[model samples]
Target chain A: MIDAKHLTKTYGTKTAVDDLTFTVRPGQVTGFLGPNGAGKSTTMRMILGLDAPTSGTVTVAGQPYRDHPRPLQVVGALLEARAIHTSRTAYHHLLALATTHGIGAERVRQVLEQVGLTEVASKRAGGFSLGMGQRLGIATALLADPETLILDEPVNGLDPEGIRWIRDLLKGFAAEGRTVLVSSHLMSEMAVTAEHVLVLGRGRLLADLPMSELLAQAASDVVLVRTPGADELGKALAGIGATVSRTDVDALEVTGPSAGRIGDLARDLGISIHGLVPKQVSLEEAFMDMTRDDVEFHASAGSAA
Target chain B: MSALETQAGATVPAPRAAPAGPAGPARLAVRSHPVSTRRVLLSEWVKFRSLRSTAWTLLAAVVLMIGIGWLAGWGSNDSWAELSPQEQATFSPVDITLAGYYLAQLAVSVLGVLLVTGEYATGMVRATFAAVPRRLPVLWAKAALFAGVTFTLMLLAALLSFVGGQQLLGEHSATLGEAGSVRGIVGVACYLTVVGVLAVALGFLIRSTAGGVATMCGLLLVLPTLGLLLPSSWQEHVLPYLPSNAGAAFFSAAPSADSLSATAGAAVLGGWLLVTGVAAAVTLTRRDV
Candidate 1:
């Protein structure tokens, strides 16, 4: 289990992670979600004790990570940046880290096989593709079979099969009663893999809840209506206190009303609704809505749209 | 394309094998040992030996030490007849046979800097520190391992250079039993080993390959040359204390008039190592990786 209280990190007046307090329990995957520069990496570094917190404390398995007699057995982390020396072969890289904890070459070979890097194990990391590099990083994290596994952007450069493989791997770890905390900007991946999520924006906790609850919160009542008489329906819906916005020449997006209610009202008003579909907000959309105001780099207004 | 297929084929254990259940083969029952100085030293040894640069740089140091020593011996022998009585009187065969360390030290210094800076350049220090979180063990281990390796390899190089250079020197050769000859050969290795340790400390303190190399070279090579611009009185007080000059006094068979004694030179170089080592430890433990 990982517990952090009042964690904050600042660099010369620019705060990266601010006042974050949360507990990551075992037996489930906790997704750490944030946009770029939102301190997900910084918080992970602090948890690993690679970076000292400006204030507060973060501990893994009941004590600070550095205090663990065998830190690799307690927590294994794959940092966002590639941490393997490019000049060294994948096998040697894993061997060097494993040797620190007296982990044997057999365990190193096991992790290599687990990550599907057994074939390229003897090759220098500099020659590996992006997907291969991610696999090596995962292999390094899994070397000691720790109780808690922390991975930053684990699937950033993975292929579809690799992504699916990592998802299963994380789920398996969780199923085995190990704590898994993965950070990523990819909400779709998290939606499938994470049972719980801690969302961060501008270095503050925006939401710390179960994935089901978050998805439920993101579910909107807005319905999309298609009709030849969209203008008439929009006017009628607006008059009845529903938010109506024209999306196409013949369609209207109506909020604050159920699809069935919109259909019945359209029928009553002779609007001749041909299509009425309720919009379901995806985790991606929910995340965007939650962090829209907190995005650090805003592409000039309409450019992104 | 064929290689890609083989890679994909190997990875497809069961295309869509049910995610490894809690009791799957994915789990390995491996035992973990606590981090200790010995294990960290072993880890560092592996890291040191795994890199190609280590082998190449050490090879360069070895070859330069022996090869240049031979050349210096041959050159001095060829010029012996042209030497005046005063010049002949001042000539020390021990100094000529061990002179290759002048160039060999550069190779050793570069390797020392690369040992630490290479990790920073590749982001590997994060993994290293994460594995051994108390962190200082890693610095200490690298220094200890590097010093051991440098001393062993450079000592061998020094011995070969002395024997080979003496052979080339013919009648002018100095035997190991000659005064200061044994100290010259052993002291060259000791001096290079200390310089290597100092480079490792500088590597940690600077944490950049270029910056560490420049600073190390500047202290050893440039700083001494720059000192000549000082007044002659100031030069006597300061130049002998610079890292290279102080180190030279330890290994130089014919001690210069302005240089410190052998024991004092070792102390001064030891002082340099202590100061840089402490600063490196402070930065390493206190700063973020």
Candidate 2:
């Protein structure tokens, strides 16, 4: 388990992580959701003891990361994809890290194979493509088979296959009772992979909720209704306390009432109902609604387009 | 055999593995054991050898040492023989062993600086600190690793330069077993290693690859060259403290009038190394990784 209490980090006059208090429990994948420059990297760095926290403490298994006897064996992290010397071969890079913990060369070979990097283990990392480099980074993180894994943007440059592979690998890892914290800006990906989520906006926690609860608490689930007599249908739906939005001359997007109920109401009013379709709430829409007021840099470009 | 063994396996309990930390059933054991310096040294040794740059730099330093000594032996024969009796009187066989020390020192110092500063330059220092989060162990390991490799290479370079210089000198040369000659060669090697370590310490303090290299080169080469341009009084007062000047004293069979006494140079070099080492340790421990 990883725990942080009142953790804060600041650079000059700007705060990067403000009063972050959360526990990342084992046996599940916790998705850290945030936009770019929203403190995910800073928090990870602090946990690794790469950066000093301005205030508060963070610990892994009740001991600070710096104090852990065997850090690599306890916590495996990939905070940056290219956090290695570009000139070194993948095998040598992992070997160096493995040697630090008195781990044998066999473990390095196993992880290289585990990450599907054995074929390119002898190649210089600088020559690898971005996706390939990310694979090497993941291999280094798994070198010691640590109990906890923290990945930052692991799927940023991966192919569809690689993405699915990571999802399955993370699921399997968590199933073995290890803590996995994956950070991403993509809501759709996190919605499917994350069992629990910690959402951040403007360097502060906006919501810490389960994935199922987040998907369920979407603003409203709408149903599209097409009717021949829209005025009469609107009156009937309004009378039943259903909110309706006009889409066209004969279509209305109705919320707060089920499709079946709306159809019965229209029939009772003698209005011909043509279309009644339920609108599924996408995770992107739900995420936007949850973080709408807290987004640090709202995409004004979207509105302009 | 299998039937009876399988029956025993089903009835008898297997030895359970040791429990891990309370984070729950961890796939890997939580190594809560205390860290030892041996582990740190092993880690550093692996880090040093894994990089191709380390090999290249060491190769360059050895080549520079042997190449410069051979060239000086062949080219300076006439100059040595043609020297006035007064100048010829000052020549020593040990000087030939160290003919390449000045040039090779530059490469060795660069190696030392790059040892630590490359991590800082590429932001790989973060990865290093994460691996050894106490931070001091990383610095200590780096210093020990650099010192160990440099000392080995410097000793080899000294031996090669001496043998090759004697081959060029022919009848004029002295052997390693000659009185005081062995001390001179070993002393030169020791001096070079000390200067290299000083560069490593400076690299940690500066934390920039180019800046550390520049500072080391300036200290090892530039300061002594500038000392030549100064008046004899100022030169005598300042030259002993310069790394290069003090180091050259170790190669000389007899101390020059303007240079520090051989014993004095040893003391001064020790002082310089001590100050640099302490500053490096303090800065590394106190600063953010």
Candidate 3:
């Protein structure tokens, strides 16, 4: 389990992570969602003790990361940067890290094979393609067989097959009762893979909701109605606490009231209805709606096009 | 076995095998060892030897040590007949034997800087720190492994230079038994070891490659030359303490006027290194990676 309480990180006058308090429990994948520069990487760095938190404390299992006797064994983090030296072969790089914890060469070979990097183990990491490098990074993270895996944008440059491979790997890790935290700006991907999400916007927590809960709350399940006496029907629906959004001159999107109830009320009121359809809310719209107010950089070029 | 593919057989657990222990369920034991200084030292040795640059730099230092010393001895012997009476009377065979160290120290020390700074330049420090989050072991391991290798190898180069140089000197040659001869030879290797260690400390303090190399050059090379422009009275008090000038006293056949004795010079160089080391440790532990 990873726990961060009141964590804040600031660079000069700009705050990167502001007073974040959350717990990442084991047995599930927690998605860290944020736009670029929204503090996901900084928070991960703080947890790994790479960067000091400007204020507050973060711990893995219990104590800070530095206090762990076997840090690599406790947390395996694959940050955005490809941390391998470009000139060294993959075998040597893994061996160097393995030796630090008195880990044997056998474990190194196992991890290399585990990541499908055994074939290229002798090759210089500089020559590996983007997907290969990502695999190598994952191999290093698994070298110690860590209990908590924190991956930052693990699917950035992967093919569809590779993406599915990582998704299954993450699910497997979680099923093994390991804590898995995956960060990504890709909402569609996170919607499918993550069971719980911690969304950040402008360095502050915007939403800390379960995936199913968020999807259900964003679930449109709304009844749309068109009638000649729309004004009278709107007042009656409002009296029943159903939220009515005027979508057109004669149509309204009604929430809270079931289609059967709205139809019965309209018929009893003697108002003729032209259309009564329930609108389904897409997952993409739910994610966009949550972050719509949080996107710091407006896309001027895309808007222009 | 294919990567990530487990054998579903009865021979093995077919999944994560658990060690027999009470730490958790008789399942996934998560065998992991703690970081040890010895392991870090071994890891550093692996890093130090794997790079193409490490091989080339060590080779260059060895070649420079033997090549320049041999050339200096040969040149001195060839000019013996043309030397005036006073010049002949003042000639010292020991000086010619270790002359290559002046150039070789640059090569050895720059390699020291690269040993640590190269990781930073290539974004490998993150991987390094991620493995050992306490951070200082990485610095200490680099320094220990680097100093150990440099001292061992450079000492051999110095011995070779001395043997080859004395041969070139012919009748004018000095034996190791001669006054100040062994000191001149061994002192050059000792001085280079100190230089290499100081460069490693400077590398951790200044993470940038260009900056670390430039600072090393300024400390060992430029600052000493700049000392020449100092007023003569201040030069006697200040120049003798500069890293290069003090290191110069170590390999000299006799202590020059206005400079510290060889013992004092080594101590002064050691002092500079100690300060550099402490500063490096403090900065490394205090700063963010």
Candidate 4:
């Protein structure tokens, strides 16, 4: 388990992570969601004790990470940046880290096989492709079979198959009662992989809840009513305290009422309703809505178009 | 094996024996032990030997020391007959035999700087520190490993150069039993070892490879030359205290008039090592990796 309280990190006058307090429990995957420059990497660094927090404390497995007798056995982290020396081969890189905790070379070979890097284990890491580099990073993280695993942007350069494999791997880790915290900017990926999420924006906790609750919150009740007499139905719906906007000549998008109620009202109004479809809000759109005001860089609408 | 075949056929790069099922934690059979100084030293040894740069740099240092010492001996012998009485009187065979250290120090110091700066350049320090989060052990281990290797190999080089160069010197050769000859031979190796440690400290203080190399060269080579522009009185007081100048006093068979004694020179070099080492330790434990 990982627990952080009042965590804050600042450089000069710019604050990266501010007042973050949360607990990542075992037996489930927690997704750390944030846009670029939103301090996900910095927070992870603090948790690993690679960076000292400007204020507050973060601990893994009941104490600060540095205090653990065997930190590799307690927590294994794959940082966002490639941490392996480019000049060393994959095998040697793993061996060097493993030797610190007296972990044997057999364990090194096991992780290499687990990450499917056994074929290129002898090759220098400088020559590996982006996907291969990510594989090596994962292999290093899994070297000690720690109780908690923290990976930053593990899917950044993975193919679809690799992405699926990582999803299964994380789920399996959680299923085995280990704490897994994975960070990603893409909410769609998290929709399938994460059971709980902690969203950050402008270095503040924007949302900390279960995935099911977040999806349900994003699920809107707006229904689309298509009828030849859309104008008449729109006036009747607006009079009953429902907001109605004409999307097309014969379609009325009605909010604040269910599809059944809207259909019943249309029949009561003597309008010939051809279709009534409720729009399903995607988690991507919901994420955009939640973080729209907190996004650091706003691409102009015209430029995006 | 069937799973591997199917994965290869399907072009899925990662395929395990089975997906880590919920049967139990994906635990390996490896035993865990606390990180100790010995294990960290072993880890550093692995790191030091794994790089091609380490072997190449050490090789260059050994070849330059022994090869150039032999060449200097041959050159001095060829010019011995043409030398004036005064020039011939001041000539020391021990100095000619150890002349290779002048060039060999560059190779040793560069390797020292690269040993630390290389990790920063490649982002590997993060992994290194994460594994051994106390952080100071790594600094000490690197210094220990580099010093050990450099002293052993350079001592061998010094001995080989002394024997070979003395052979070339013919009748002008100085034996190991001669006064100050043994000290000069062993002192040269100690001088190079301390130089390597200074470079290692600078590598940690300045984490960039270029900056570390430039600063190391500036202190060991450029600063001494720049001191030559000073007035004679000031030069005696100042030039003798510089790193290279102080290091040269103990390793020279005949201590120069303005330089410190052999014991004092070693103390001065130790002073340099102590100051830089403390500063490096402070910054390393305090700074964000």
Using DockQ as the measure, the top candidate is 1
Which pairs clash in the backbone of model 3?
A: none
Which residue window of length 10 is worst by lDDT in model 1 chain B? B9-18
A1-305: candidate 2 lDDT, tens digit per residue: 99999999988998889999999999999999987777988888888888889999999988999888888878888878888777777888887777777777887877777666666777777777667777778887877778899999999777666687678778777877889999998998998889999998767887888888887876356999888888888877888898988889999998889988988887777888888899877778777776776666667876521
Instruction: Write candidate 4's Cα lDDT for B155-258 as tens digits.
Output: 99999999999999999999999987888889999999999999999999999989998998898889999999999989988888888878888989876789
Give the CA lDDT, 0 to 100, for residue A50 in model 4: 94
Error of 2 at A154 (Å): 1.6
For residue A123, model 4's alpha carbon misses the true position, in angstroms, by 0.3
- Angstrom error of the Cα, residue A9, model 4: value is 0.7
Best by lDDT: 1
- Per-residue CA lDDT of model 2 for B107-216, tens digit only, reads 88888888888777766677777778887777777777777888888888888888888778776677888865777777778888887889889989998988998998
**Alpha carbon deviation, residue B201, candidate 3 (Å):** 0.9
Candidate 4 at A109: error in angstroms?
Answer: 0.6
DockQ of each model vs. true complex: 0.57, 0.23, 0.34, 0.54
Segments in model 1 whose C-alpha atoms lie over 4 Å from true places: A301-305, B1-19, B23-26
Winner of 1 and 2 under lDDT = 1
**Candidate 3, DockQ score (0 to 1):** 0.34
State each candidate's clash count.
0, 0, 0, 0
- List the global CA lDDT of all models: 0.89, 0.79, 0.85, 0.89
Candidate 3 residue-wise lDDT, B1-289, digit = tens: 2123212111211112222223345344445688877878888988887899899999999999999989888988888999998878878888777888888888987899999888888778988999899998888899888888888988899899989999999998889899988888778888899999999999999988789889988888898889889999888988899988798798888556777888899999999999999999999998888
Candidate 3, chain B, TM-score (2 decimals): 0.88
